[model samples]
Target: MRRLKWVSIVAVGLLISLSGCKIVKNPDPDSAGQADANLTDEARMAALARDIWDTDVLPTVAEHLVPIDDLRVSLAQNEQAAGQSHGLRPEGEANPWNFAVSGSGSIVEANTTSRAAKLQVDTTGDGAADVTVQLGPVIRGTAIRDAMPFLIFTDFRDQIEFAKLAGGLNAMAHERLSLPEGDIIGRTVSFEGVFTYRDLASAPEVVPTALSFEAPE
Candidate 1:
């Protein structure tokens, strides 16, 4: 019993010595605060999107834009040729070709039921849908990013960043957009934006950076 008591005392002493030698200080609060202050990937991309939207992105879109009416004809004749002329795609990449286009049309249909909403535009004035304009808080695809010549994929850290930038740009555009509260069928609208499709046979899904609803005249 005495030996056990002596061993217990030695064990306690050793533990106390070890604890004294290894000081476990709390982590520096400032370091943790600084890390928290750092911009998240989404914030970073959104800032980048805002920085470039007017100065770089808009100008680039204008430079590459083809009229929807003309694009339809071009696609009908030779999609590859049209894409080569008006679209942007990496030389050897399998990504879909992206194009900037402008058109004014009547809103024949507004599918606002889905979060991935779309407006069917009748550009021809014949009361049929010519193109689809994406109205998104939830947008799909990276058409804008792929279309911009200046926003090279290699310029970003990786595919995730690039994709987020696309989303940021889409969100930025959505921020500027002001949709009409009531029914908008037959309302005249004009838009300039980017789009992508797997084949020329498919209608363009336009992600409008600029969308203007014409005042009834």
Candidate 2:
């Protein structure tokens, strides 16, 4: 009789636990951390850019930085294989593969005259740029926007709004980038940047999230 009573109590406790559980059907991880719906479009764009750059971009790159040399070698073999190994392209995305890369190299060229200012980095020590990093009042390409796997195209109202978000992110990059006040020519600089390349043949055009120069020696 005592054993039966104990079993009944255990059964009751199990039933209570089951009653408290709620099943979430088809939960989307990306949607869980989306921008505030109440925010204005302009404000939402800015917020998304900050969230992508500061919260997602930096930490994700820091954890999975691909070396320049390895990238070139892998990319030569095959684009799909290279992307899977060293970078990311959203599932079923026909877009260029986006990569997070870090390397120290000399700035062979600086085009500060143009509003779309850029530094040509020679990471291979060969006198030519292995990659071009945009430091911009006008940054080109959708590298930052593309790097964000969470910001799905369908999430935005339309394609035009998506383009605006890209523009906002470029503006954010320009605002954050700090270059040496003096001549930056031939300066040894280290950077953590993101770039997307459609073709395997052309050099990467990167958008840096973290860039710093080594003090002149």
Candidate 3:
């Protein structure tokens, strides 16, 4: 009887030990549902910006770009009409017309530190520049995303994330679109981009989504 009792106790202990050694699978090693949960705020914002730029902004801008000259003419004729025609107007703001513009020009000057450049473009191929195109300084602002008529505050979780998304897109533009400092000087360049008109009377500065250059042909 004593031997039988001892044997039974040993069998229970062995079973417990075996059970402890058994491999337990993690419920979320792939982290599918929890992927965003682990991301930092900046990382999440950047990811969202990249996704939106790829899926919404890029295609929309490409399809809807207005010629820089035409945009200028419209603004000159009537700023309010131009803003409403091609862009979404905030309830009461008069500046920052959200629109896309495209043109080719010679780089008159460049400021790489500021990430901006001035272009002298003659849209009609006239001898003189019809306009001085400001290439950027796109290092900040929610202008790009805000300019998209389809996108609104409700599209994002909050203003903070929305602001971060803009910053992310700006960073991406500087990374992917900007030219080397002196390389663009005197080079003929073509660009398609979005801009916010701070003042209709002043030259429009563009934040380029597509830019290319080569020796003038």
- The 0-to-1 C-alpha lDDT of every candidate, in the order given, reads 0.85, 0.81, 0.69
Number of the candidate with higher TM-score, 1 or 3? 1
**What is the C-alpha lDDT profile of model 3 across 1-217, one tens digit per residue?**
9999999999999999998796887678568657878887778878877777878878888877888878878888997888777764333474466787888866655555555545665555555555454445455455577666665667778878777777777766655665554556667778887777777555556667888887554
Task: Name the 10 consecutive residues with the lowest summed lDDT in model 1.
Answer: 28-37
What lDDT is reached at residue 160 by model 1? 84
Task: Itemize residue pairs with steric clashes in candidate 1.
Answer: none
CA-RMSD of model 1: 6.1
Model 2 regions more than 4 Å off: 1-43
Candidate achieving the largest lDDT: 1
lDDT of 2 by residue, 1-217 (tens): 9999999999999999999999778645457344365456777787777767778767776776798788888888887888888786655757668898888899999998799899998998988887888988888988777777777889889987788788888888788888888888888989887888767668888888888998876
What tens digits encode model 1's per-residue C-alpha lDDT throughout 103-173? 99999999877888899999988989878999987888888877777788788889888888989999987
Model 1 reaches what TM-score against the true structure?
A: 0.78
> What's each prediction's TM-score?
0.78, 0.76, 0.72
Q: What is the C-alpha RMSD of each candidate to the true structure, in Å?
A: 6.1, 12.2, 5.0
Model 1 shows how many backbone clashes?
0
